[model samples]
Target: MTQTAQLYRMVMEDHVCPYGLKSKDLLERQGFAVDDNHLSSREETDAFKKEHGVDTTPQTFIDGQRIGGHDALKKHFGQDVREEGETTYRPIIAIFSVAALMALALAVGSLGTVLHIRVLEWFIAISMCFLAVQKLQDVESFSTMFLNYDLLARKWVPYGKIYPFGEALAGILMVGGILPFLSVPVALFIGTIGAISVFKAVYIDKRELKCACVGGESNVPLGFVSLTENLMMIVMGLWMGTKAFLL
Candidate 1:
C-alpha cells in the first residue's frame, strides 16, 4: 500500500517556501503520495497557522498526525536533523566537491591528463578561490568569525578583511602558474598563520567554535576541515614555490 502524507506549504506570488518544496520532495522520495496543500496568500497562510496552532509552514501530516516542517519530516524518517546554528560540513564539502570536479574537467580538457600533479594543484587552487569567494561575499561577517580564532586577524584586525583577497589572488595566480614571486609568499604567510592559529585554537586550547573558512554565515565547526584548509594552502605554497624556483 502506498503511504499517504499531506503537506501544507506557502506558495505566494513573490515567494515560495523552500522548505515546503523540500518536504514534498522528501515525501515522494520516501515512497509517500503527498497531497501538497499550498497556502496562496498571506491571509490564507496566517489563517492556516492560526487554525493549526503552528508557528511555521511546510507542516506535514502522516496518518492524520502532525509532522511539523522539513526538519521535522526528516526526523520522522529517522534522518539527521540539523538544528539552527548547528555545525555542518555541507558547505565546505560542496565547495571542495565542485572544485575537484572542475579541476578534473579542466585538466582533461587542457592538458589531456586525468590524474597528474597539475590536476592536484588546480584542485587546491580552485578550492581556495571558491572558499575566498564565500568569505568575500560578506567580509564583515567573515572577519568577525575569523577574529574568534585567527591569531594575526586578532592582533591586526585589518588582516581579517584582507585575508580573503590574499587567498583569492594566490589562488588565481596558482591556477595560471603566474607571478609565483607574489603568490608564493602570500600563500605561505597566510597558510602558515592560519595553520598555527587553528592549531592553537582547536588543538592546544581546545576551543570549539565555528570555522569562518566558508564565511561568517557558515556553521562549519572548527576542527579537521579547518586544519585541512590551512594545510593544503601551506603545501600548495611550498610546491608552487619549489616548482617556480626549479623553473
Candidate 2:
C-alpha cells in the first residue's frame, strides 16, 4: 500500500556515494515514487546522518518507517543482496570477447573474406595481446604470482617481468604479418613453457590458485583456461613457423 518512499543520500561535491544511485534506481524499478533527498555538503550529510541515527547514506524510509541503507533496503523489499568481492569469470570473458570481436573485424576488413584460418590467426594474435595488456597492468603483482608456478619465472625472475612485453610484441608482429622469425620463436618458447608449467601445477602438483592468464587480480582458475591459452599459442606458433618455412 506504500506507493511513495523517501531516500536520504549523500550528494556532496567530494563524496557522492554510489549506493545512493543504486538505491534510487531500485526504488524506481520497484514502482515506488522516491523523494530523492540529497545532502549536498559534508555538514548537511553529517547532520542528516546524526538526525537519522544512521552511519551510512542512502537511508530509505517508507511510511515514516526506516528501511535502512542500500543492502538493508534490498532486504526489506525481499531482494537478493550481492556480496562484496564476488569472484567471477567476467575478466577473462571480457578479454576474450573483445579479442574475438577485434579478430572478426580485422578478418572482415583486411581480406574482404572471412577465412577460417585467417580468423583463427587474428583471434590468437589479438587474444595474446589482450592477455599481455592485462599482465602489464600490474607487472609486479603478476610477476609475484607467476613465480609461484612458472618454471622460467621461478628461476630467472626477470622473465616474469619481461614476458608480457615479449608476448605483446610477438602478437603485434603476427597481426602485421611481419617478422615471423622473431615472432614464431617468441610464441613457441613461451607457449611451450606455459603449457608445461600449467600441466605440472594443476595436474601433477594438484595446486589450486587464481590464473595470471587474465591478470594477477583475476578470479579465473589456474587450470583449463591457462592451458588453453598456452596451447593456442603453441598451435599458432607452429602454424606461423610452417608458413614462414614454406615461403
CA RMSD, predictions in order: 2.2, 2.4
- What is candidate 2's CA lDDT for residue 234? 90
Tens digit of per-residue lDDT, candidate 1, span 107-211? 999989887888999999999999999999999999999999999988999999999999999999999999999999999999999999999999999998999
lDDT of the candidates, in the order given = 0.94, 0.89
Which runs in model 2 stand beyond 4 Å of their true positions?
50-54, 62-82
lDDT of 2 by residue, 122-183 (tens): 88999999999999999999888898899999889999999998889989998886899999
Worst 10 residues of 2 by lDDT: 80-89
Clashes by residue pair, model 1: none
**Model 2, CA-based lDDT:** 0.89
